[model samples]
Target: MTRPQPRPGIDEIKPYVPGSAVTGFDGPVYKLASNESALGPSPKAMEAYEAAAGKLHIYPDGSARVLREALAARYGLAPELIVCGAGSDEILQLLCKAYLGPGDNIVMSRHGFSVYHILAQGCGASTKFAEEKNLTADVDALLAQVDENTRILFIANPNNPTGTAISGEELARLREGLREDVLLVVDAAYAEYMDWVDYDEGTSLVRAAIGTGAENTVMTRTFSKIYGLGGLRLGWAYCPPSIAEVLNKVRGPFNVSLSAIEAGVAAVSDDEFVDDNRDHNRRERARVTQRLRGLGFEVGDSHGNFVLAKGRGDAPVEDVTALIEFLKTRGVTVRQMGGYFLPDYVRISIGSTEANDVCLNAISEFASQ
Candidate 1:
């Protein structure tokens, strides 16, 4: 039986492999694979989510105006420029669908978020990767890769897997030199975890563009990280008015759910909760990196809520694989970075103090062996 053909690049997409969730031997599995919050959502957000249960029969506000307004209050972004989506992932997909096509290409850092590469391929567009210097996005290298075919360029500040970031000045330099025709997307999924004086998550650029009536750049954010709403699939993008209009037309009418909207609105209002999560992540991230280094591992300095643990020993790849197996046996789940081309590294999220201790102790045991 012959079937209708799919798109040219559809088959080439290796679907995203998420971080591991459980350990087979789990009595109490310490999940440090996904970069989720150590402390969960605010009590206010949880109450809002539960309150939404009564309205399940009715449809959500198609525009998500209330949530947009709340986000505007929190971030000082113009409500008209914000477009809510199921997740930043959905917004990214919308960007690809709106701009990508055969012969078009997207450029991103070599170790940037994996979803960018997958999304570009799914849209029948090719992806170009610029080499990273010291596990950080090299602005010049990224710009050098751009040509006539490049339609979009993505930079994940506090990038996934490696958890490294470039200074805002560096980012601005890239934007200043970039072709005005290319859409530059700054994915700030882990922005909430960063407090480095030099980091701005491209907001300054977006604000500057908005002031100049420019529309070639956008910044995307997620509720999944700091808000602990990963399960609810909520995120939004702050775009120039023109880009927002394009996204609104192509996006689902109710891309964000009632519960997600309510929770998100309440979550942003809980400034204390966000601050506490930031504090916990900051403290634990440093401790984890310190402990991993104490174990003789080459741990990278990370701004996000995770650290990349690389084996410093000879045969780093084999050592990392052995470390993974050893940790799994002890009921610890951590992310392997092979998919991101860092086969010798493991990305461990900063979990609760107990969870962090468990993971650190497990690695310590493995190193001792």
Candidate 2:
């Protein structure tokens, strides 16, 4: 039997692996992987989902009008400038498909989101990796890698795993320095968790760029993190009207589900829930970071929902591995950062007071061993 040949680039691509939900143990396990909200979806979002359940047989709104209008009002952007997708990940893929090609290249940092590289490869595009300074996107380093062939620059603000963020000034410098033709794709998936003094989350930056007759900047955001709508796979991108039109052409009609649209609409209007979660994350993130530091681990300055803790340089890999296993036994699950190219580090998402206590106790027990 003869099999059809696939693109050479496709053969070499490795798929993105999300955090696992199932552990071998039968008892309850607290998941700290995937950086999801520990408190779960907003009460209003759940209610919206329940209400939409009865209409499952009917097709969802192909344009996701309700969610788009809600998002526009919340962000102070026009609905025409926004395009909703099944998830922010899907929107990323759509961007690649719409902008990249065989000879084009995408610029990203060394430890940037793995999806950027994967999607670029799938589009048969070359990827140039710049060195990240202190687990943050080095704008200077990234600029050095940009050339005539570079068409897209992907930066995850308040980036995942490391949870580091870039300032608005620094991001502006990078944008101003880039060539006129290059598109700056800012992935603000973890933006909601950030409350830094002067960070912009690239929203105003993108808006400013477009206002100044530069339509090359685009920003993508997700309801998954702050709104607790990860399971619904709802996200949206803010771009120039022309870019949004192009992306909408390639994106699947009805890409977002009916329930997801309802949930997203409700979540955006639930400002109280957003504020409470942000407040909880701010307090708990500090608590978790301090505890980890006390355990002889070096943790990065994190602004997102999670913190990254590193074992001593000389510590055995087995010791770190053992710590993860021990934590699992205590029904606590945090992400092992081997996939993020930081094998010595682990990422723990901030949970409720009780969950945080359980995780901290597990860390102490493992370190004491």
Candidate 3:
């Protein structure tokens, strides 16, 4: 008897490995693995989430209307140009589904988010990785890799794992160089955490795509970061009318949950909460980076809520496993970077003051030993 088979590229796709949440030590664990907000969700959002429990029996608004309008008002974008999804990850998946095929390919930075690779492969498409300079996306190198077959170009500003970012000028240059037909998707998942002068969230680029005949750019964002709604899985994209229509057509009828919608509406409306969260992250992130540098680790100037740090001295790669184990013994969970091909580095999320102190003390102890 013959067995059924999945799609061609499905088997070949490497499954994504999330940061480890487990530890051997029977003590308090500080989960600084994933880049979750240390401040937690807005109290108003929590109230909305609880209130939405009564509406679980009813189907969510397929359009996610109120949430879209809230995002629009907050960001100063047209509501019709927005497309909400379960998370920004789903928005990427929808884009891949609509645009990618066996012969097509997507281009992205070598050290960028790994989910882009998985999504492209799921659509039976290949991914081209451009080399980065100083752990940041190089506009010239990325453009060089985009050939005739490239359908999409993905950029995660203040990129994950590495936590480096390119300037707004570089982003615009990349867009100008791309073919009019190739879709440019800027994944600004960590945008809210970036308080840098040169940082651009790619919203202007998305708006620029409107009047231009070639409406080929998109900017995707998340509620998981500054909004602290990672558990609810709400995200959205700023798109041109054409792309928004395409996504709306292909997406699940009620992709976002009722709870997610209500919480998102409340979260976005609470500007004071977001401001406080950003301020806390800015302070903590700077402290963490400075302390890690003082510990002799090679740390980039990260704009995101996490820092990517490599071990001390000449043979850093050899120190990775031992250091991670040492931190585990101290009940701190930092992500290993073997999956991102940076075996020497570890990514640690910025946590509360107490949590940060615990993690730092663990590393300091490891260094002494």
Candidate that would win on lDDT: 3
In angstroms, how far off is 350's CA in candidate 2? 1.1
Which has the higher TM-score value, candidate number 1 or candidate number 2? Answer: 1
TM-scores of the candidates in the order shown: 0.98, 0.96, 0.98
At residue 219, candidate 1 shows an lDDT of 95
| Model 1 C-alpha lDDT per residue in residues 189-257, reported as the tens digit of each score | 999888789887877888776676656889999999988889999999999888999999999887899
How well does candidate 3 score on lDDT at residue 300? 88
- The Cα local distance difference test for each model comes to 0.90, 0.87, 0.91
Candidate 2, residues 1-369, lDDT tens digits: the string is 999987769998888887656467777678887788868899899999999889999998898988889998988888988999988999999999999999999999887888999999999998999999899999999999999999999999988888998998999889998987899999999888877777877777678778878788999999999889898898899998778989999998879998899888989989889888989998999999998898888998898899988865587456667778888888888777786688888888898888899889888988887
TM-score of 3: 0.98
Pairing residues by index, what is the TM-score of model 2? 0.96
Model 1, position 201, has a per-residue lDDT of: 83
Candidate order, lDDT descending = 3, 1, 2
Instruction: Give the poorly placed runs of model 2, Cα more than 4 Å off.
Output: none
